[model samples]
Target: MKFLEENLLDHLQRPEFAELHSVLINHKFSKGSYICQPGMGSNQVFIVVSGRVRVYLGCEEKEFNLGILTKGDIYSTHTGTFVQALTDAVVLMTDVKTFRQRMVGDPEVTKAMVRVLGNILKTSFTIIDGLAFKDVNSRLVALLSNEARRHGMSLEDGSVQIQIDLSVEQIARLVGSTRQTVSMLLSDLVRAGLIERPERGKFLIPNLSALESVGGVTLS
Candidate 1:
C-alpha cells in the first residue's frame, strides 16, 4: 500500500544512496515463515521487495495485527512485533548500524525514515482507537475503506473495485475481531448494496462514498 512517505529506494539512482543499496542483502522467506519474533533482539532494517508480511503482536492464544507490509514497504526489526510472511517473499535488509550510518550522510534517507516512522505511529493510534471506541462492524468497515483507498481501482461507473486477496480469517485478525463476525459483516455489506463479491478475494463498491459513510470513522 502507498503511504505518504517517499520510499527509501526512490533515491537508489543517486550516488549518495549507492552505499546503502550496496549493503542490502537479499533474503527469501517462505509463506508462513516468521521473519522476526518478539524478543528476538534483531537489529536489521528490512525493505520488502516482493510478497506480503503481517506485522502483529501478542501470543499464540491471541494476537492483534498492526498492519500488512507489501512490496516497497520498509520496516525495522527493533520493534517487538512479530513479522510473518503471508506469502513467499523476498526482502532486502541491512544491519541497523549500517542503515543509521548511511542516513547520517543522506538527508533524503533521513526524511524517508522519519516519514515511515510517522506512518507507523499513525497506524498504531488508529488501531488503538478502533479497539477502545469502535465496535466490530465499524472496525471492519474502516479496514475495508482503508484498503479500498489504498489498493482500489476506479471504474467507469464511479464504482471502486478492490482486489484484496485476504481471507475472512485474515480480515478478522486485521480488525481484531472473530472470523464469524467478519463473515457476517461481509454478508451484511453485500446485502446492503455497499459491496459486491464478484469473485473470491475481490470486492466491488457500488458507491465509494456511501461505503465510507457506513464506517463512521475518518480514514487516514
Candidate 2:
C-alpha cells in the first residue's frame, strides 16, 4: 500500500489527478478468481500495486491470454474484462469513463494517454501480422522472446528467467494453438536440453540461443 502510493502518488499529484485518484478504489482477488467475462460493463482502470495480471481476448468462447501484466502496469475495463490477477493481488481502480473525460480535459494527460492508445494500435498491427505470417510455434517463440526482453531476470547461468510462470494451456491460448501441441513442443524442447522445466509449469530459458529454433525473431 505504502509502495503503491510512493510510486504513483507523485506522478498523479495534479489537483485533477488527485480528484481522479480519490475516486479510485481498491480490490483484492484470490488466486484463480475469474475477474472478467465477456459482455460485462467495464468502468474502471486498474493499476496493480502488488502481484500480476493476465490480460486476454477470446474467440468462440475460448479466452486467450494476450500477455501477463505486472506491477506498475495500467489497464482498464476496455473490451469486456481484459484483466485478471494470477495470484493474491491488489489493484488501484479508477472509473474509466471519468478518467477518459479528464484526459480530454487536460492536454498533458491527453497526450500521455494518446501515446498509450497508439501503442495499442501498434500491438494490434503486430497481432495481425503475426496471425497471417507466423506458425504457432514461431508465434509462441516470438511472444516468449518479447516477454523475456521485458520481464526476464538475469540468471547466474547467463540465460534469463522469465518470472511470469505459465502452463502449456496458457501458452497455447496466447499462441492460438491447442494445449496438446504446446505440450508436444514443450516436451521436445525439454528433451533436447534446449529448455528446462525446473518447476511445474515453468520453463527456464537458460540461454537465449536455445530459442533460435523457433526462429525469425529480431532480438536486440
Candidate 3:
C-alpha cells in the first residue's frame, strides 16, 4: 500500500486497522476547496494522502495562515478551524471515534500520536512567535530560511537554492502580510544581495548570513 511505502500509516498498521480499511472514506478536493470550516462538525480526522492543505484563521477578507501540511500529515480539531486544499488533494477521512478505537490495541500508534502532538506543539509556538514578535520582513526571511533548510539544493558556491513556486499572494498570506508589502520587502532583500530569483519560480540565497541579517534571524 502507498501508506506503507510512505510510512504514513506506520503506527496504525497493526491488525487493528484492517477493520478500518473497509470504512475509510477517500475523497479528492480541487485546489482552493475547503476541507472543513469553522462551525463544521469536529468529529472527523483527515489524513492527507497527496497534495497540500492550508490551516488558517480569519474571514475571507483577511487570513492568518497557521501552517501548510502535505502528504502524510494529519489534522483534526475539537473546535474546527478553516482548512482548505492548497492543491488538488487526496485525503482519507474517518470519524474521531473510529480513529480512537483503532488506537486501543497498538502501542506504536500511541507513540505516533505523541510524536505528532509534539510537532504540533512546536509548530504552534513557532507560529505564535512569528506573529507576536517578528516583523513582516523577518517573518518572510524565516519562512525562506525554513524552506532552505527543508528543501534547498546546495550549490558549489556555498549558496542554497529553494524551488518554492509560491506566488507573492500566497507568501503574503503565509506571513500575515499583504502582497504589496511582501513584494516591497522582497525587492529590498534583492537589493541587499540577500535573495535572488534565479529563475521564474525559484529563490536563491547567495549569502545565508546576509539573508539572516536582513531578516534578523539565524537559522540553526
TM values, all candidates: 0.88, 0.80, 0.78
Task: List, residue by residue over 1-220, the lDDT tens digit for candidate 3.
Answer: 0111134555345565777544568989998898899887667877777886777676566665555666776677553468888679998888889888755765655565465556556656786898899899899998888767654789999999986556888788878899999999998888888899877558999987778877888654
lDDT by residue (tens digit), candidate 2, 102-175: 55555554454454445455555676777789887777777767766666776886887665556778778777
Candidate 1 residue-wise lDDT, 1-220, digit = tens: 4443344556665776787788889999998898899889889998888887877777555566666777777888888888898789999999999878766767766666667677667778888898899999998888778767876788999998876667888778777888998999999999999999999778999897898788896855
TM-score-wise, the better of 1 and 3 is 1
Global CA lDDT computed for model 3: 0.73
Give residue 94's lDDT in candidate 1 (0 to 100).
91
Candidate 1 vs candidate 2: the lDDT winner is: 1
TM-score of 2: 0.80
Regions more than 4 Å wrong, model 2: 1-10, 13-18, 100-112
**CA lDDT of each prediction against the hidden true structure:** 0.80, 0.65, 0.73
Clashing pairs in 1: none
lDDT of 2 at 178: 92
- How much does candidate 1 score in TM-score? 0.88
